[model samples]
Structure formats: C-alpha cells, structure tokens
Target: MDNFLETQLHPAEICVVCTEPFSLSHQPVALPCKHIFGHECIKKWLKSGQGNSSACPTCRYVVVEKRTPRVDFDTSSIWKALCDQPPERLNSLMMAIWPGLKILWQRHPSGNFSITEILDQAVIPALIKTARRTESPQDRSYDPVLDCYNLVAASWDSLGRPDTATGLAIAFVRLARLMSTASATLPKWLTSTARTNRLLWRANASLGIFELDVSWDFIIEATNLEEEQYFPLLHLYTVLVSQSIAHNSQPTPWPTRRHDIMNLVVERCCTKIGGTFWKGKPSNKFKDVLVAVYEELRRYQLEKGKMSLRGHDGEERVVKGIWALAGWTAKKVEVR
Candidate 1:
C-alpha cells in the first residue's frame, strides 16, 4: 500500500487542506485507506474529532493512527523553492507559509521578538509590495495583511507586551498611510483607520501614553460622531477618561491644554447623554458607561489632588451639571 501510494502521488501534489503544493513544511502522510494528506492537516483533523476517531476527507475511512508521522526536511531549501515561484503565485505561497510561521512564532519563548521578526521579515514587506503592485480597490490580496496584523496584535496582547503591540499599531498606521496613497476610497481608508485607532487606544492606555488628541483625531476620522450609536461613543469616552487619569498622574506637570481636552471630552459625553435624557429615552448602557467614566475622573481628582486649578470654578460647575443631568447626587457618585 505504501509503495502504491508513493507511486500514485508526486512531491509536487497539493495539500488538500492548505491547497498548496506539498513541500517540506507540508509533507504528506498516508492513511490506512491509502489516502494521502499533509501531516499538519491530518494532525489537526484528528485533534478536532471526538475520542481519537476521525474519517479521511477523501475516502471517509476511519483513521486509526495513534500519532501522525513526522518527516524531517530542509526548511531552507523549501523556502528557497517557494521564493522562486512566479510573481502570480506569491500570495498563495505566503498563505501556505503562514501556518508554519505562526507555529514557529508560538514556539519561541519571547513573543515580542518573534512577532517583530515576522513583521519585519515577512508580513510588512509582503503587504507593502502587494499594495504597491495592485491598484484596484477590489483586490483581495490586502486581506492577508489585515489578518496577519490582527494575529500579531492578539498574540502580543496575550503575551502582555503592550509595548510591542503599540509598535505594531504604529506600523499599522504607516501601512494605512501607504494604502491611502494607493487611491484607497473613504470606506477602505476608514476601515484601516478604525483598526489602527482601536489598537493604538488599547496599547496606549496600557502603556499610559495618554495622547488623547491623536486618539480623538483618529476616532473622528474613522467614525461619524453624529451618526454613531452607543458603543462607539462608549469606547471614545472610556479611552478619553482613562487616558486623562493616566496623563494626570505622570511626573511632568499636567498641561492646562490636557485639562481642556478632558473638559471637552466630558462635555461631549454630557451633551450626548443629555440629548437622550431630554427625549425621555436614555440608554442604560450609555448612562452606565458615562457613570463609570465620571467615577474614574472623580477618583483621579481625589487621589491626585486637583486635576485643574485654572478652570476650578468652571470645571466644578460642569461636573455639578453633569451629575445633576445623570440624576446622581454627590454622595452617589463618590469614589469608593
């Protein structure tokens, strides 16, 4: 059976799971039914089944191997072969290599270093080259870049490396800029902009960067404020308030301009909530998020002395009004 299978299959045959030609990374493993598949594909297939029972994709024969066979081959030669593929096949080769790249990254001790190498060596260059080569808005090649970025971001977050995450976020902004120059329309630009902002907001908040102005600019460009619903507004308020507290606590004296930005963010939050309240139709979620933001602000003010003395009276008045609008007394909103 092994001889027959070997005679029937060629090294150049494609893997059924990845749909790419078999190479060192995707060596074929034969089943009892004489069906051949990539080793990784069959391993995943068996693992996804119940109690080690699985069927072959081609012949539906019950797979009985206790373990998938492993084959050792020269990765360098395989990579060289892939690199030698024609230009049109580059995307497919990239897709084929992605799983192995991810596996290599996961096995590394330092996720930060692994992700950095992946981005610097493979993902970024491929994305930039692909973007430059393809001018059509309808091209699907760019999807891989977004996917790879998300994967890296998620991995970095899981590894608690917000510094690296922030770096990747900045790289995404650069990628977005490149995409913008490629005649990207509003929707495409906005998609990239929103993704960049989301990553930046989370990373910056974690790192206490607190650059609210830049974050707000990205938010405004990505979303239409008037047409936005609750969650977007909620995200904006949360980022603004959290970063305000962070900025206030920095060693450098808090800038008066930052106080104004905080005030502006608060005012916008109140205006939105007030509109809903006046209509006798306030969203509980919106109010809850606003209340959380207010609570955080109040906590910062009490813990870090006064956040602002320049607008002491005016800030007090605005806080009082916002509390009143929310139907909350001073006691109800005190920091615990």
Candidate 2:
C-alpha cells in the first residue's frame, strides 16, 4: 500500500515543494526518483542550493551525472611532410622567419613588409607547429633552441643536408648563443650548434677532410644575416691551425698528426672565438701559412670551371668552387 502511494499522483494534494495545490500555474512534474512536485517548485528546489541541489528534493536522489576530466589535443597545423619536405619549402622558411631583417627594411618609408602580422599569422605559427614535433601537447613546453634545432635538422636531413637552411640556422644561433656563457662572445651561437652543422659537414668530414664549404651560392640572393661565414670556410683549417698551433701546448705538431691538432684547435676556436659571426668576408692572412691542408674548385664544379681570388700571399685561393684540395702530395703556394 505504501509503495503504491509513492507511485500514485495526488493532484488534489498540495505540492510538498511550495505547499501549493496543483492548478494551471502549479503544474506537476515527475522526477527521476519517482517523486512529483509543482513544476516551478521542484525547479526552484534543484537550482536554489537549499539542500542537495543535484538530487530530487523529496527523495534526495541525484538527477545529473558528474562529468569526468578529459584530454583534448589539437594537431592540425603540424605539416605532415616535416621529415621529407623538399628544398623549396626550406628555401621559403629561410626567407620567412627573420623578423629582424624585416624590421630593418621596414625602416624605409616604402617598406610593405607587415612584420608583426606576418609573424603572428605565419612565421611563429609555423615554427610553433614544427616545435610540437618534440613536445607533449598537455605540457606544451616552449624551448627556443631545441625548437629551432628540430626544424633545422628536419629540413637539412629531408633536403639531403643542403646548405640552404641558413635562416633556421641563424635563428637557432640567436637563441643558443647566449646560453653557454654569461658575457656575449663573438656572437658565437654557431659553436653551440655543432650537432646541427654536422648534418652538412658530415659529407666531407668522413673522408678525413673537415670542412664546411662556403660558396657564392650560400651568400647569393637573400641569406640569413646574409650570413657569410666569418672564417673563410675553404681556408678555415688553415686559419684555425695557423693561429692556434703557435701556442704550442698541443701534444703533437701539425702535418705529422693533422687530425689531432686540427680537432684540438677547432675545439679551442669554438670555445674561444665562437661563431655567432654572420657578417663580413674572411681575412686571407692564412694564405701566408704553410699548406698543411687544402681543397676547393668544384669552382664551377657546379658549372665547368673553377674560380679564384689572388691571395695576400699571391697564390690563388678559391673564392668560389666545389672540388676539395687535399692529400699527402700537397703543394705549397707562396704568398708575396
């Protein structure tokens, strides 16, 4: 009898919620717990926080479910071709990322480069998307060098380690340069990026020649900082060895053990002079140094002919070329 009464509707009885009798305005409605009350009265009870708001007023039964926490990640902007993008895309990246240059050019009245707009809309978004390659979407950490390095490595490797990813390299250089030391030295960000530069240097490095060949093509068109290498890359070994060896604390001298000394001096140079340098042509003082190392002239190695500049020492030093000059039969060119 009691169970039947709980289920039965008593329209003539006053609503427990509002102490009101059912009428046109006091319409009755049933709850999930099989309790009924005047429509507005029950709604006021549930929403008023007078007691257990989630439960039916009469039966104290929960009406709505408690929602659980969720993980929502969006991956739409990451380019699918990141690991295998073509050179043209890398070229575009080279042009797009350097806002500093755009800022410089925009100083002119006619400059139309929308520096902030382009970065907010295009450049930063693209780099952030690329940076996500190494990130947890939930954590979403932002590291400038690590982020730039990832894009650089992906582009260099995808495009067969081409020298054209200069913009990305320069950006990475700016980020990394200040981290290793307290005071600024040589704008030396490139030294910190050995791992990134090695992607390209690996080609000739294994053949017992360690060189990052710089040519006109590298500097041609718009470049990152128009980033001509500070040390003439072709004669870099000469410059590094010639300068550092005179200190003579090195265990073995040059020629007898070139690689060991070469490694030592290069390390010292990277440690000391640093390579954030991205402006000016290389000084040719090393032309006077003995030919302990050499190569260049794939010079027209791109075309059919090689090119050269008269050295301070009067022997022709490759200003632009491709073939590498080296071997046990190395010949010496005298400087005037």
Candidate 3:
C-alpha cells in the first residue's frame, strides 16, 4: 500500500532514483532500454558511463553492446602465400576477407561530416567489421550503435553543451533513416530486429524529446516541413515539457528575475557523458551534495521559522530554505 501510494502520488512517470515516491510535479525520463528510472537517475547514469554497456536490470536485457577492435592476421603473410596459389585455390580466403575490406572502405574517417559521418564512417562500420561471420543471417538488421548513440546523446543533453550532443544525435537519426530506405541489405551477424521495429522507432523518438527541450524554434520549423523523421521531432516536444517542470523548481532572485545573471554556469550533456561522467552520474553526486545541504537548509529553515516567532534570526533561515528548494526538488524527482 505504501509503495502503491507513492507511485500514485508521484505518478508512474516520475524518476525512481532517490527512494522518493513519484510526484505529479516531477520530470519523467524514458531510457534506451525502455525501463524508466528518475530523470535525475537516468541523467546521471548517462553522464557516468554506467549505461554504456548496461542492460535492463530487471530483465537483464542488453541495452548497448561494446565495440572492440577486430583482430586481423598479418595480411602480408597471406598475400605472400597467395602469390604462388591460383586465384581459384584462394577463393575461400578472398570470400572471408572481402567483407572487412568493404567495411574499411565505408567507414574510413578522412574528412568533415555530420554525426552521420562519425557513426557511418567510424563507429558502425567498425562494429560491422568486428562482428563474427557466423553470428546471424546476412539479412539481419540489428544495430547496437543506435542505442549507444542515444545513451551518449541523453547524457550530453542533460549535462550541457547541447550543440555537440545534438550534432551526435542528428547523425544517428539521419543514418537510421538513410539505412531504412537504402537498397542495400543489412549484413549478416547483425541480429534480427524485426520484432523490435517499434523500439527502434522509440529509440529514435527519444532523441526528439531532448531536441525539443533545447529549442522550440527547431520543433516549430520541423513541423512545418515534410519530414520523415517524426520520432525525433515529437521527442523534442516531450523533452521541452519535462525540462519546463525540472527547471521550474527555484524562484528567480528578485534582481535576477528581472535580469539575467552574467555569471551563470551552463553545461550541456550527451547520454553517454551523463551515464559515465568523470565518475558517476551527476544525479548521484548531486543527490549526495544536496542531501548534505538539505540537512543544513532544513534546519536553518526551521530555525528561521522559530526565530520569526521570536523576532530573531529570521532572514538567514528563509535564505537557506530558498537555496535548498532546487536540490530538494531534484531529490524528490530523481530515482536511483
């Protein structure tokens, strides 16, 4: 009953990180694994790298797969051996190695390109090259890079420097679309994801949510166009709504309310940055720091309330309460 009430009060949509009950007032974040933690929890997780190779803890479902370099034999020796052998005798080796050559040609990084270029030119091509030859049917289309990209984008979007993060995300969306329509078939060794078509759509959808949070102008402009990537654009709308709630916790100081602060610090994040930040997610650190401050702030607020009754020590208490609310609210909405 307690758990039920907590979820009810908070709404199932809110973050589940801080052991706090869900709140109707908090922000809700959708993760790549299709699991929901608190916005704060997910944000911090994305920043810290915990989400990099993570799976859905509840189901042990893989969210993102790691990419490692493929091992290559000394082709110099193979070439020397092949020089004396007829082309017909070397058919097996040529068949075995040709795919690697194709992947290398496609992904080589040599020039400036969009996020699409980074993934197609370097990341996805690398994965394709590394995959085991016998892993799956040649028609299988599962690409883990999309999930990895989403996690990276999510981490960066929340932490700051949204421009860089946005670039990364846009690249994936573009590539996913391009691949969807291209005449070429997905190579074997990629898993079959026909059953997860919607999730693929959802993953793409999630990107737009963050984009929306970053700018309404982009959303408005996107809506007016005949665009095929609807998921990212709709996601932007969702992100804007979530951000509005999360950001509304503190009242602007009177002077600053009237005027913007010149010294304000702003950090944009991608999902990967948030998942495995310098150490852990910002949510985790933010919670620990806020909890300490909250203890003091709550005590000060109480002391001020008490002092106000006695006409002493009132101002400091009120100031502390004001300062503590942002952290408190963050704690309230964040899940672990």
What TM-score would each prediction reach against the true structure?
Answer: 0.22, 0.24, 0.20
Better of 1 and 3 by lDDT: 1
Could you say which candidate leads in lDDT? 1
lDDT of each: 0.41, 0.37, 0.35
Per-residue lDDT value at 13 in model 2: 66
Tell me the tens digit of each residue's lDDT in model 2 across 163-192: 332434433333222121111221233333
Answer with 1 or 2, whichever has the higher TM-score.
2
Q: lDDT tens string, model 1, 1-336?
A: 999897976554877767877788789888888777889887777666454346787777876544443232233332333334454444332343333344434665322233355444444555444433344322323234334444444655577753343433444332222222111111223323333244222322322221211233333222222323222333433333443443433434432453453445445444422222122333443444355445546565667674421112234334333434444432354432
- Cα lDDT tens digits, model 3, 92-120, are 22233334334544564221233434343
User: What TM-score would candidate 2 get against the native?
Assistant: 0.24
Candidate 1 lDDT (Cα, 0 to 1): 0.41
Worst 10 residues of 2 by lDDT: 177-186
In model 1, which residue pairs have backbone atoms overlapping below 3 Å? Answer: none
Q: List the candidate 3 regions with Cα displacement exceeding 4 Å.
A: 1-117, 120-122, 125-218, 221-232, 244-251, 254-336
